[model samples]
Target: MFLADAGVPTVSWNLLADLQEMWAYPFMVNAFRAGAIVSVVCAVVGWFMVLRRQTFAGHTLSVAAFPGASLAILLGVSTSLGYFGFCVAAALLIAALGRKGRDAGAEESAVTGTVQAFALASGYLFISLYKGLLEGPTALLFGSFLGITTGQVTLLAIVGAVLLAVLALIGRPLLFATVDPEVAAGRGVPVRLLSTVFLVLLGAATAEASQITGTLLVFALMVIPAATAQQLTARPGRSLALAVLIGFASCWLGLIAAYYQPYPLGFFVTTIAFTGYVLAHLGRAVHDALGRSRPRGRTPLSIGGAA
Candidate 1:
Protein backbone atom coordinates (compact mmCIF):
# COMPACT_ATOMS: atom_id res chain seq x y z
CA MET A 1 0.00 0.00 0.00
CA PHE A 2 3.04 2.26 -0.29
CA LEU A 3 3.51 4.34 -3.42
CA ALA A 4 6.54 3.25 -5.48
CA ASP A 5 7.65 1.13 -2.58
CA ALA A 6 11.21 -0.17 -2.43
CA GLY A 7 10.95 -1.82 0.94
CA VAL A 8 10.17 1.48 2.60
CA PRO A 9 8.27 1.46 5.89
CA THR A 10 4.63 2.55 5.82
CA VAL A 11 5.00 4.77 8.87
CA SER A 12 6.97 8.02 8.84
CA TRP A 13 10.70 7.64 9.27
CA ASN A 14 11.41 8.16 12.98
CA LEU A 15 14.86 8.54 14.54
CA LEU A 16 13.97 6.40 17.53
CA ALA A 17 12.57 3.68 15.32
CA ASP A 18 15.70 3.72 13.18
CA LEU A 19 17.88 3.43 16.28
CA GLN A 20 15.76 0.59 17.61
CA GLU A 21 16.02 -1.24 14.31
CA MET A 22 19.79 -0.86 14.29
CA TRP A 23 20.09 -2.13 17.83
CA ALA A 24 17.83 -5.10 17.19
CA TYR A 25 20.67 -7.09 15.63
CA PRO A 26 23.26 -8.85 17.80
CA PHE A 27 26.15 -8.00 15.50
CA MET A 28 25.29 -4.33 15.67
CA VAL A 29 25.25 -4.50 19.46
CA ASN A 30 28.69 -6.11 19.50
CA ALA A 31 29.96 -3.53 17.03
CA PHE A 32 28.78 -0.67 19.18
CA ARG A 33 30.26 -2.17 22.32
CA ALA A 34 33.65 -2.74 20.77
CA GLY A 35 33.57 0.68 19.16
CA ALA A 36 32.86 2.42 22.44
CA ILE A 37 35.86 0.82 24.12
CA VAL A 38 38.12 1.49 21.18
CA SER A 39 37.01 5.11 20.93
CA VAL A 40 37.69 5.88 24.59
CA VAL A 41 41.09 4.22 24.70
CA CYS A 42 42.28 5.70 21.43
CA ALA A 43 41.08 9.16 22.35
CA VAL A 44 42.86 9.16 25.69
CA VAL A 45 46.16 7.81 24.41
CA GLY A 46 45.95 9.90 21.28
CA TRP A 47 45.63 13.07 23.32
CA PHE A 48 48.95 12.26 24.93
CA MET A 49 50.47 11.43 21.57
CA VAL A 50 49.44 14.81 20.23
CA LEU A 51 50.75 16.64 23.28
CA ARG A 52 54.11 14.87 23.01
CA ARG A 53 54.48 15.23 19.24
CA GLN A 54 54.39 11.46 18.79
CA THR A 55 52.11 11.13 15.81
CA PHE A 56 54.90 9.74 13.65
CA ALA A 57 55.73 7.18 16.27
CA GLY A 58 52.06 6.25 16.58
CA HIS A 59 51.82 5.85 12.81
CA THR A 60 54.88 3.60 12.78
CA LEU A 61 53.38 1.40 15.45
CA SER A 62 50.15 1.16 13.46
CA VAL A 63 52.10 0.17 10.36
CA ALA A 64 53.83 -2.49 12.43
CA ALA A 65 50.44 -4.12 13.04
CA PHE A 66 50.03 -4.80 9.33
CA PRO A 67 53.04 -7.07 9.25
CA GLY A 68 51.92 -8.70 12.43
CA ALA A 69 48.47 -9.49 11.14
CA SER A 70 49.68 -10.71 7.77
CA LEU A 71 52.30 -12.93 9.37
CA ALA A 72 49.65 -14.32 11.69
CA ILE A 73 47.47 -15.17 8.72
CA LEU A 74 50.39 -16.83 6.99
CA LEU A 75 51.17 -18.87 10.11
CA GLY A 76 47.52 -19.80 10.67
CA VAL A 77 47.46 -18.21 14.10
CA SER A 78 45.13 -15.78 15.80
CA THR A 79 45.56 -12.35 14.19
CA SER A 80 45.20 -10.60 17.53
CA LEU A 81 48.29 -12.34 18.86
CA GLY A 82 50.32 -11.17 15.91
CA TYR A 83 48.95 -7.66 16.17
CA PHE A 84 49.97 -7.25 19.81
CA GLY A 85 53.29 -9.08 19.49
CA PHE A 86 54.74 -7.17 16.55
CA CYS A 87 53.44 -3.80 17.65
CA VAL A 88 54.93 -4.21 21.12
CA ALA A 89 58.24 -5.35 19.70
CA ALA A 90 58.33 -2.42 17.32
CA ALA A 91 57.55 -0.04 20.16
CA LEU A 92 60.45 -1.39 22.17
CA LEU A 93 62.78 -1.06 19.25
CA ILE A 94 61.75 2.53 18.68
CA ALA A 95 62.09 3.44 22.32
CA ALA A 96 65.53 1.89 22.50
CA LEU A 97 66.80 3.52 19.34
CA GLY A 98 65.44 6.96 20.18
CA ARG A 99 66.92 7.75 23.56
CA LYS A 100 66.10 10.95 25.40
CA GLY A 101 68.90 13.41 24.64
CA ARG A 102 70.06 15.99 22.16
CA ASP A 103 69.40 14.94 18.54
CA ALA A 104 66.72 12.63 19.85
CA GLY A 105 64.20 13.99 17.39
CA ALA A 106 66.29 13.04 14.38
CA GLU A 107 67.06 9.62 15.78
CA GLU A 108 63.44 8.87 16.59
CA SER A 109 62.19 9.94 13.19
CA ALA A 110 64.85 7.92 11.41
CA VAL A 111 64.15 4.82 13.46
CA THR A 112 60.39 5.10 13.13
CA GLY A 113 60.58 5.66 9.37
CA THR A 114 62.84 2.65 8.95
CA VAL A 115 60.51 0.47 10.99
CA GLN A 116 57.47 1.63 9.05
CA ALA A 117 59.15 0.90 5.71
CA PHE A 118 60.20 -2.59 6.76
CA ALA A 119 56.82 -3.31 8.21
CA LEU A 120 55.07 -2.39 4.96
CA ALA A 121 57.42 -4.53 2.95
CA SER A 122 56.98 -7.44 5.30
CA GLY A 123 53.22 -7.19 5.16
CA TYR A 124 53.23 -7.33 1.35
CA LEU A 125 55.70 -10.22 1.39
CA PHE A 126 53.43 -12.16 3.69
CA ILE A 127 50.49 -11.40 1.50
CA SER A 128 52.34 -12.68 -1.56
CA LEU A 129 53.40 -15.83 0.26
CA TYR A 130 49.92 -16.44 1.61
CA LYS A 131 48.55 -19.33 -0.39
CA GLY A 132 45.34 -21.31 0.04
CA LEU A 133 42.98 -18.50 -0.92
CA LEU A 134 43.46 -15.90 1.75
CA GLU A 135 40.47 -13.64 2.18
CA GLY A 136 39.67 -10.36 3.91
CA PRO A 137 42.60 -8.45 2.44
CA THR A 138 40.36 -5.43 2.07
CA ALA A 139 39.15 -5.89 5.60
CA LEU A 140 42.74 -5.89 6.80
CA LEU A 141 43.37 -2.56 5.12
CA PHE A 142 39.98 -0.97 5.61
CA GLY A 143 37.80 -2.53 8.31
CA SER A 144 34.52 -4.37 8.62
CA PHE A 145 32.07 -4.29 11.52
CA LEU A 146 30.03 -7.29 10.41
CA GLY A 147 32.18 -10.07 11.81
CA ILE A 148 33.03 -8.69 15.29
CA THR A 149 32.41 -11.45 17.81
CA THR A 150 31.45 -11.22 21.47
CA GLY A 151 34.81 -12.66 22.47
CA GLN A 152 36.62 -9.93 20.55
CA VAL A 153 34.44 -7.31 22.24
CA THR A 154 35.31 -8.73 25.64
CA LEU A 155 39.00 -8.73 24.85
CA LEU A 156 38.80 -5.12 23.75
CA ALA A 157 37.02 -4.18 26.96
CA ILE A 158 39.62 -5.86 29.18
CA VAL A 159 42.58 -4.41 27.33
CA GLY A 160 41.01 -0.95 27.21
CA ALA A 161 40.38 -1.00 30.95
CA VAL A 162 43.95 -1.93 31.74
CA LEU A 163 45.30 0.75 29.43
CA LEU A 164 43.03 3.38 30.95
CA ALA A 165 44.05 2.42 34.46
CA VAL A 166 47.72 2.63 33.61
CA LEU A 167 47.26 5.98 31.94
CA ALA A 168 45.41 7.32 34.95
CA LEU A 169 48.16 6.19 37.33
CA ILE A 170 50.87 7.91 35.34
CA GLY A 171 48.82 10.80 34.05
CA ARG A 172 50.20 13.50 36.38
CA PRO A 173 53.95 12.88 36.10
CA LEU A 174 53.60 12.04 32.45
CA LEU A 175 52.00 15.39 31.77
CA PHE A 176 54.77 17.15 33.66
CA ALA A 177 57.40 15.28 31.70
CA THR A 178 55.70 15.94 28.41
CA VAL A 179 55.37 19.67 29.01
CA ASP A 180 58.97 20.22 30.13
CA PRO A 181 61.08 17.11 30.06
CA GLU A 182 64.32 18.76 31.21
CA VAL A 183 62.65 20.46 34.15
CA ALA A 184 60.72 17.32 35.06
CA ALA A 185 63.88 15.23 34.95
CA GLY A 186 65.74 17.80 37.04
CA ARG A 187 62.87 17.60 39.55
CA GLY A 188 63.35 13.81 39.90
CA VAL A 189 60.76 12.63 37.37
CA PRO A 190 61.96 9.62 35.41
CA VAL A 191 61.42 11.04 31.95
CA ARG A 192 63.06 8.13 30.20
CA LEU A 193 60.93 5.57 31.98
CA LEU A 194 57.81 7.54 31.27
CA SER A 195 58.72 7.74 27.58
CA THR A 196 59.15 3.97 27.40
CA VAL A 197 55.86 3.32 29.16
CA PHE A 198 54.00 5.78 26.95
CA LEU A 199 55.33 4.22 23.75
CA VAL A 200 54.26 0.79 24.88
CA LEU A 201 50.82 2.10 25.70
CA LEU A 202 50.64 3.74 22.28
CA GLY A 203 51.55 0.47 20.63
CA ALA A 204 48.85 -1.37 22.49
CA ALA A 205 46.33 1.28 21.53
CA THR A 206 47.33 1.05 17.87
CA ALA A 207 46.89 -2.70 17.92
CA GLU A 208 43.52 -2.43 19.60
CA ALA A 209 42.28 0.20 17.18
CA SER A 210 43.49 -1.85 14.23
CA GLN A 211 40.86 -4.44 15.05
CA ILE A 212 38.15 -2.00 14.08
CA THR A 213 39.84 0.41 11.62
CA GLY A 214 42.58 -1.86 10.33
CA THR A 215 46.29 -0.95 10.47
CA LEU A 216 46.30 1.57 7.65
CA LEU A 217 43.42 3.68 8.93
CA VAL A 218 44.17 3.45 12.63
CA PHE A 219 45.11 7.14 12.75
CA ALA A 220 41.53 7.97 11.91
CA LEU A 221 40.65 7.08 15.45
CA MET A 222 43.81 8.28 17.20
CA VAL A 223 44.92 11.48 15.52
CA ILE A 224 41.85 13.21 14.17
CA PRO A 225 39.83 13.51 17.34
CA ALA A 226 42.76 14.58 19.44
CA ALA A 227 43.91 17.09 16.87
CA THR A 228 40.41 18.55 16.61
CA ALA A 229 40.10 18.84 20.35
CA GLN A 230 43.47 20.54 20.61
CA GLN A 231 42.38 23.01 17.98
CA LEU A 232 39.35 23.91 20.07
CA THR A 233 41.00 24.19 23.49
CA ALA A 234 44.34 24.77 25.19
CA ARG A 235 43.33 23.33 28.56
CA PRO A 236 44.63 19.79 28.84
CA GLY A 237 41.69 18.33 30.75
CA ARG A 238 39.02 19.88 28.56
CA SER A 239 40.87 18.90 25.38
CA LEU A 240 41.22 15.30 26.50
CA ALA A 241 37.55 15.04 27.40
CA LEU A 242 36.53 16.70 24.15
CA ALA A 243 38.68 14.29 22.17
CA VAL A 244 36.98 11.32 23.81
CA LEU A 245 33.56 12.72 23.12
CA ILE A 246 34.46 13.45 19.52
CA GLY A 247 35.76 9.93 19.02
CA PHE A 248 32.62 8.42 20.54
CA ALA A 249 30.36 10.52 18.34
CA SER A 250 32.38 9.69 15.25
CA CYS A 251 32.31 5.97 15.89
CA TRP A 252 28.60 5.81 16.62
CA LEU A 253 27.62 7.92 13.66
CA GLY A 254 29.98 6.03 11.38
CA LEU A 255 28.51 2.73 12.50
CA ILE A 256 24.98 3.86 11.83
CA ALA A 257 25.87 5.33 8.45
CA ALA A 258 27.70 2.19 7.40
CA TYR A 259 24.76 0.07 8.51
CA TYR A 260 22.44 1.90 6.15
CA GLN A 261 24.92 2.45 3.34
CA PRO A 262 26.97 0.19 1.10
CA TYR A 263 30.45 1.49 1.94
CA PRO A 264 33.03 0.24 4.41
CA LEU A 265 32.91 1.30 8.07
CA GLY A 266 36.43 2.68 8.01
CA PHE A 267 35.53 5.04 5.19
CA PHE A 268 32.65 6.48 7.14
CA VAL A 269 34.65 6.74 10.34
CA THR A 270 37.67 8.40 8.79
CA THR A 271 35.53 10.77 6.79
CA ILE A 272 33.48 11.85 9.75
CA ALA A 273 36.53 12.31 11.94
CA PHE A 274 38.24 14.31 9.22
CA THR A 275 35.16 16.47 8.86
CA GLY A 276 35.14 17.28 12.56
CA TYR A 277 38.81 18.20 12.45
CA VAL A 278 38.25 20.50 9.49
CA LEU A 279 35.35 22.19 11.20
CA ALA A 280 37.32 22.70 14.35
CA HIS A 281 40.16 24.30 12.45
CA LEU A 282 37.72 26.61 10.70
CA GLY A 283 36.07 27.61 13.95
CA ARG A 284 39.41 28.35 15.56
CA ALA A 285 40.48 30.48 12.63
CA VAL A 286 37.28 32.53 12.83
CA HIS A 287 37.63 32.98 16.56
CA ASP A 288 41.18 34.19 16.23
CA ALA A 289 40.29 36.61 13.46
CA LEU A 290 37.42 38.05 15.45
CA GLY A 291 39.59 38.51 18.48
CA ARG A 292 42.13 40.36 16.38
CA SER A 293 39.50 42.63 14.84
CA ARG A 294 38.10 43.83 18.19
CA PRO A 295 39.65 46.99 19.66
CA ARG A 296 41.62 46.56 22.86
CA GLY A 297 41.28 49.39 25.50
CA ARG A 298 39.18 52.42 26.50
CA THR A 299 39.85 54.73 23.57
CA PRO A 300 36.25 56.11 23.58
CA LEU A 301 36.51 57.15 27.26
CA SER A 302 39.73 59.08 26.55
CA ILE A 303 38.06 60.94 23.62
CA GLY A 304 35.00 61.84 25.76
CA GLY A 305 37.20 63.18 28.60
CA ALA A 306 39.22 65.25 26.11
CA ALA A 307 35.98 66.66 24.56
Candidate 2:
Protein backbone atom coordinates (compact mmCIF):
# COMPACT_ATOMS: atom_id res chain seq x y z
CA MET A 1 0.00 0.00 0.00
CA PHE A 2 2.82 2.37 0.88
CA LEU A 3 4.56 1.63 -2.41
CA ALA A 4 1.31 1.70 -4.41
CA ASP A 5 0.49 5.17 -3.05
CA ALA A 6 4.05 6.40 -3.63
CA GLY A 7 3.62 9.13 -6.24
CA VAL A 8 4.39 12.78 -6.80
CA PRO A 9 2.40 13.65 -3.72
CA THR A 10 4.06 10.97 -1.67
CA VAL A 11 7.55 11.92 -2.72
CA SER A 12 6.60 15.57 -2.43
CA TRP A 13 5.25 14.95 1.05
CA ASN A 14 8.53 13.39 2.19
CA LEU A 15 10.41 16.23 0.57
CA LEU A 16 8.16 18.90 1.98
CA ALA A 17 8.07 17.19 5.33
CA ASP A 18 11.47 15.73 6.37
CA LEU A 19 13.42 17.57 3.71
CA GLN A 20 11.78 20.90 4.28
CA GLU A 21 11.82 20.48 8.01
CA MET A 22 15.58 19.85 8.20
CA TRP A 23 16.41 22.54 5.68
CA ALA A 24 14.21 25.03 7.49
CA TYR A 25 16.22 24.56 10.64
CA PRO A 26 19.27 26.85 11.01
CA PHE A 27 21.16 24.40 13.21
CA MET A 28 21.01 21.72 10.56
CA VAL A 29 22.38 24.15 7.99
CA ASN A 30 25.21 25.17 10.30
CA ALA A 31 26.05 21.56 11.18
CA PHE A 32 26.12 20.57 7.53
CA ARG A 33 28.32 23.52 6.59
CA ALA A 34 30.62 22.95 9.54
CA GLY A 35 30.91 19.28 8.71
CA ALA A 36 31.88 20.06 5.11
CA ILE A 37 34.60 22.46 6.19
CA VAL A 38 35.96 20.09 8.83
CA SER A 39 35.97 17.26 6.32
CA VAL A 40 38.27 19.20 4.02
CA VAL A 41 40.65 20.02 6.83
CA CYS A 42 40.68 16.45 8.06
CA ALA A 43 41.29 15.04 4.59
CA VAL A 44 44.25 17.29 3.88
CA VAL A 45 45.94 16.80 7.24
CA GLY A 46 45.11 13.13 7.25
CA TRP A 47 47.37 12.58 4.23
CA PHE A 48 50.40 13.58 6.25
CA MET A 49 49.12 11.75 9.31
CA VAL A 50 49.11 8.47 7.46
CA LEU A 51 52.39 9.20 5.75
CA ARG A 52 54.16 9.91 9.02
CA ARG A 53 52.36 7.08 10.77
CA GLN A 54 50.72 9.60 13.06
CA THR A 55 47.26 8.12 13.00
CA PHE A 56 48.03 6.98 16.53
CA ALA A 57 48.72 10.59 17.46
CA GLY A 58 45.47 11.71 15.91
CA HIS A 59 43.50 9.09 17.80
CA THR A 60 45.27 9.92 21.03
CA LEU A 61 44.61 13.61 20.63
CA SER A 62 40.94 12.95 20.01
CA VAL A 63 40.64 10.96 23.22
CA ALA A 64 42.83 13.36 25.17
CA ALA A 65 40.39 16.17 24.42
CA PHE A 66 37.79 14.73 26.77
CA PRO A 67 38.95 16.34 30.00
CA GLY A 68 39.17 19.79 28.50
CA ALA A 69 35.69 19.44 27.05
CA SER A 70 34.43 18.21 30.41
CA LEU A 71 36.11 21.06 32.21
CA ALA A 72 34.49 23.53 29.83
CA ILE A 73 31.12 21.98 30.42
CA LEU A 74 31.67 22.23 34.12
CA LEU A 75 32.63 25.89 33.81
CA GLY A 76 29.78 26.70 31.47
CA VAL A 77 32.10 27.57 28.59
CA SER A 78 32.51 26.51 24.99
CA THR A 79 33.57 22.90 24.73
CA SER A 80 35.46 23.65 21.53
CA LEU A 81 37.80 25.93 23.46
CA GLY A 82 38.42 23.22 25.97
CA TYR A 83 39.03 20.70 23.22
CA PHE A 84 41.59 23.00 21.60
CA GLY A 85 43.31 23.56 24.91
CA PHE A 86 43.63 19.88 25.64
CA CYS A 87 44.76 19.02 22.12
CA VAL A 88 47.43 21.69 22.08
CA ALA A 89 48.78 20.57 25.40
CA ALA A 90 48.75 16.96 24.38
CA ALA A 91 50.31 17.74 21.01
CA LEU A 92 53.18 19.54 22.64
CA LEU A 93 53.65 16.72 25.08
CA ILE A 94 53.76 14.13 22.33
CA ALA A 95 56.22 16.18 20.30
CA ALA A 96 58.52 16.69 23.27
CA LEU A 97 58.45 13.12 24.54
CA GLY A 98 58.74 11.52 21.15
CA ARG A 99 61.67 13.72 20.12
CA LYS A 100 64.34 11.04 20.59
CA GLY A 101 62.58 7.69 20.49
CA ARG A 102 63.89 5.18 17.97
CA ASP A 103 60.26 4.42 17.30
CA ALA A 104 58.34 7.68 17.22
CA GLY A 105 55.17 5.76 16.61
CA ALA A 106 55.54 3.69 19.74
CA GLU A 107 56.44 6.72 21.82
CA GLU A 108 53.49 8.68 20.51
CA SER A 109 51.13 5.81 21.22
CA ALA A 110 52.41 5.62 24.79
CA VAL A 111 52.01 9.34 25.42
CA THR A 112 48.57 9.30 23.86
CA GLY A 113 47.57 6.35 25.99
CA THR A 114 48.62 8.09 29.15
CA VAL A 115 46.79 11.23 28.19
CA GLN A 116 43.71 9.28 27.25
CA ALA A 117 43.47 7.64 30.67
CA PHE A 118 44.14 10.86 32.57
CA ALA A 119 41.76 12.85 30.40
CA LEU A 120 38.97 10.38 30.87
CA ALA A 121 39.50 10.29 34.63
CA SER A 122 39.65 14.05 34.82
CA GLY A 123 36.49 14.36 32.82
CA TYR A 124 34.66 12.18 35.29
CA LEU A 125 36.06 14.07 38.21
CA PHE A 126 35.05 17.37 36.68
CA ILE A 127 31.58 16.06 36.07
CA SER A 128 31.37 14.98 39.70
CA LEU A 129 32.45 18.42 40.89
CA TYR A 130 29.30 19.81 39.39
CA LYS A 131 26.92 16.91 39.81
CA GLY A 132 23.48 17.46 38.36
CA LEU A 133 24.27 21.06 37.61
CA LEU A 134 24.41 21.10 33.82
CA GLU A 135 23.67 19.26 30.64
CA GLY A 136 25.49 15.97 30.16
CA PRO A 137 28.84 16.13 28.41
CA THR A 138 28.03 12.95 26.59
CA ALA A 139 26.40 14.94 23.81
CA LEU A 140 29.64 16.83 23.28
CA LEU A 141 31.58 13.59 23.46
CA PHE A 142 29.21 11.80 21.11
CA GLY A 143 28.59 15.01 19.16
CA SER A 144 25.59 17.31 19.23
CA PHE A 145 25.61 18.30 15.58
CA LEU A 146 22.00 19.43 15.67
CA GLY A 147 23.06 21.84 18.36
CA ILE A 148 25.72 23.58 16.24
CA THR A 149 25.21 27.33 15.98
CA THR A 150 26.12 29.99 13.43
CA GLY A 151 29.00 31.16 15.59
CA GLN A 152 30.51 27.65 15.53
CA VAL A 153 30.10 27.51 11.78
CA THR A 154 31.99 30.77 11.42
CA LEU A 155 34.76 29.54 13.69
CA LEU A 156 35.06 26.32 11.74
CA ALA A 157 35.24 28.23 8.47
CA ILE A 158 37.99 30.51 9.69
CA VAL A 159 40.11 27.77 11.26
CA GLY A 160 39.56 25.41 8.36
CA ALA A 161 40.60 28.06 5.82
CA VAL A 162 43.74 28.92 7.70
CA LEU A 163 44.68 25.26 8.12
CA LEU A 164 44.17 24.54 4.43
CA ALA A 165 46.26 27.54 3.43
CA VAL A 166 49.10 26.46 5.66
CA LEU A 167 48.92 22.93 4.30
CA ALA A 168 49.14 24.22 0.72
CA LEU A 169 52.07 26.51 1.41
CA ILE A 170 53.96 23.94 3.39
CA GLY A 171 53.03 20.89 1.34
CA ARG A 172 56.27 20.39 -0.57
CA PRO A 173 58.62 20.88 2.36
CA LEU A 174 56.44 18.89 4.68
CA LEU A 175 56.35 16.01 2.20
CA PHE A 176 60.08 16.10 1.78
CA ALA A 177 60.53 15.81 5.52
CA THR A 178 58.04 13.02 5.96
CA VAL A 179 59.47 10.93 3.17
CA ASP A 180 63.07 11.21 4.34
CA PRO A 181 63.79 13.19 7.45
CA GLU A 182 67.56 12.79 7.10
CA VAL A 183 67.52 14.13 3.55
CA ALA A 184 65.17 16.98 4.47
CA ALA A 185 67.44 18.01 7.33
CA GLY A 186 70.49 17.71 5.07
CA ARG A 187 68.67 20.10 2.69
CA GLY A 188 68.25 22.58 5.62
CA VAL A 189 64.48 22.08 6.00
CA PRO A 190 63.34 22.94 9.50
CA VAL A 191 62.01 19.48 10.08
CA ARG A 192 61.48 20.02 13.78
CA LEU A 193 59.51 23.24 13.38
CA LEU A 194 57.47 21.74 10.57
CA SER A 195 56.63 18.72 12.68
CA THR A 196 55.52 20.92 15.58
CA VAL A 197 53.38 23.12 13.35
CA PHE A 198 51.86 20.13 11.64
CA LEU A 199 50.99 18.52 14.97
CA VAL A 200 49.33 21.75 16.13
CA LEU A 201 47.19 21.93 13.02
CA LEU A 202 46.33 18.28 13.42
CA GLY A 203 45.30 19.02 16.98
CA ALA A 204 43.10 21.88 15.86
CA ALA A 205 41.44 19.77 13.21
CA THR A 206 41.01 16.94 15.72
CA ALA A 207 39.28 19.32 18.10
CA GLU A 208 36.98 20.63 15.38
CA ALA A 209 36.16 17.22 13.98
CA SER A 210 35.55 15.88 17.47
CA GLN A 211 32.95 18.57 17.97
CA ILE A 212 31.26 17.49 14.74
CA THR A 213 31.56 13.70 14.89
CA GLY A 214 32.35 13.33 18.56
CA THR A 215 35.65 12.02 19.98
CA LEU A 216 34.73 8.38 19.52
CA LEU A 217 34.22 8.80 15.78
CA VAL A 218 36.41 11.76 14.78
CA PHE A 219 39.02 9.36 13.39
CA ALA A 220 36.61 8.42 10.61
CA LEU A 221 37.34 11.74 8.94
CA MET A 222 40.92 12.10 10.18
CA VAL A 223 41.98 8.64 9.08
CA ILE A 224 39.54 6.90 6.73
CA PRO A 225 39.55 9.11 3.64
CA ALA A 226 43.28 9.54 3.74
CA ALA A 227 43.79 5.83 4.23
CA THR A 228 41.43 5.09 1.33
CA ALA A 229 43.22 7.59 -0.90
CA GLN A 230 46.55 6.00 -0.07
CA GLN A 231 45.24 2.55 -0.97
CA LEU A 232 44.08 3.99 -4.28
CA THR A 233 47.27 5.88 -5.18
CA ALA A 234 50.82 6.77 -4.13
CA ARG A 235 50.82 10.19 -5.72
CA PRO A 236 50.49 12.93 -3.12
CA GLY A 237 48.37 15.56 -4.87
CA ARG A 238 46.01 13.03 -6.36
CA SER A 239 45.62 11.29 -3.05
CA LEU A 240 44.84 14.56 -1.29
CA ALA A 241 42.14 15.42 -3.83
CA LEU A 242 40.61 11.96 -3.70
CA ALA A 243 40.62 11.95 0.09
CA VAL A 244 38.91 15.33 0.23
CA LEU A 245 36.26 14.19 -2.19
CA ILE A 246 35.63 11.02 -0.25
CA GLY A 247 35.46 12.88 3.02
CA PHE A 248 33.00 15.45 1.69
CA ALA A 249 30.82 12.86 0.00
CA SER A 250 30.62 10.81 3.17
CA CYS A 251 29.74 13.81 5.30
CA TRP A 252 27.03 15.17 3.02
CA LEU A 253 25.50 11.78 2.38
CA GLY A 254 25.60 10.92 6.06
CA LEU A 255 23.95 14.21 6.93
CA ILE A 256 21.14 13.63 4.47
CA ALA A 257 20.67 10.07 5.66
CA ALA A 258 20.54 11.16 9.30
CA TYR A 259 17.94 13.77 8.39
CA TYR A 260 15.59 11.05 7.21
CA GLN A 261 16.51 8.10 9.46
CA PRO A 262 16.04 7.77 13.17
CA TYR A 263 19.75 7.34 13.95
CA PRO A 264 22.67 9.53 14.90
CA LEU A 265 24.41 11.09 11.92
CA GLY A 266 27.95 10.29 13.11
CA PHE A 267 27.25 6.58 13.12
CA PHE A 268 25.92 6.77 9.58
CA VAL A 269 28.77 9.00 8.40
CA THR A 270 31.49 6.77 9.83
CA THR A 271 29.80 3.71 8.37
CA ILE A 272 29.76 5.37 4.97
CA ALA A 273 33.41 6.38 5.25
CA PHE A 274 34.45 2.91 6.35
CA THR A 275 32.49 1.39 3.48
CA GLY A 276 34.18 3.75 1.04
CA TYR A 277 37.55 2.69 2.36
CA VAL A 278 36.69 -0.99 2.03
CA LEU A 279 35.43 -0.46 -1.51
CA ALA A 280 38.51 1.51 -2.43
CA HIS A 281 40.75 -1.19 -1.04
CA LEU A 282 38.84 -3.86 -2.91
CA GLY A 283 39.07 -1.83 -6.12
CA ARG A 284 42.80 -1.42 -5.64
CA ALA A 285 43.20 -5.15 -5.10
CA VAL A 286 41.39 -5.77 -8.39
CA HIS A 287 43.56 -3.17 -10.09
CA ASP A 288 46.76 -4.76 -8.83
CA ALA A 289 45.56 -8.14 -10.00
CA LEU A 290 44.90 -6.81 -13.47
CA GLY A 291 48.26 -5.06 -13.76
CA ARG A 292 51.89 -6.05 -13.23
CA SER A 293 52.49 -5.17 -9.61
CA ARG A 294 55.87 -3.58 -9.09
CA PRO A 295 56.71 -2.30 -5.67
CA ARG A 296 56.81 1.50 -5.54
CA GLY A 297 60.10 1.11 -3.72
CA ARG A 298 59.73 1.31 0.04
CA THR A 299 56.56 3.27 0.74
CA PRO A 300 57.74 6.85 0.98
CA LEU A 301 57.27 8.53 4.35
CA SER A 302 54.44 11.05 4.19
CA ILE A 303 55.15 14.68 5.04
CA GLY A 304 51.76 15.64 6.44
CA GLY A 305 49.35 12.72 6.51
CA ALA A 306 46.87 10.54 4.67
CA ALA A 307 46.96 6.83 5.37
**All candidates: CA RMSD (Å):** 3.7, 8.7
Candidate-wise lDDT, in order: 0.90, 0.82
lDDT by residue (tens digit), candidate 2, 156-260: 899899999998899899999999998898999998889988998899899889888888888889999999999998988899999999999988888887665
In candidate 1, which residue pairs clash? none
In candidate 2, the residue pairs with backbone N, CA or C atoms under 3 Å apart (3 or more residues apart, or in different chains) clash, namely 46-305, 46-306, 47-305, 47-306, 48-304, 48-305, 48-306, 49-304, 49-305, 50-306
* TM-score: model 1 vs. ground truth: 0.93
Tens-digit lDDT track of model 1 for 229-299: 99999999999999999999999999888877667889999999999999999999999999999788758
lDDT: worst 10-residue window of model 1 = 1-10
TM-score per prediction, in order, is 0.93, 0.86
What candidate 1 gets wrong by more than 4 Å, as runs, is: 1-12, 133-135, 299-307
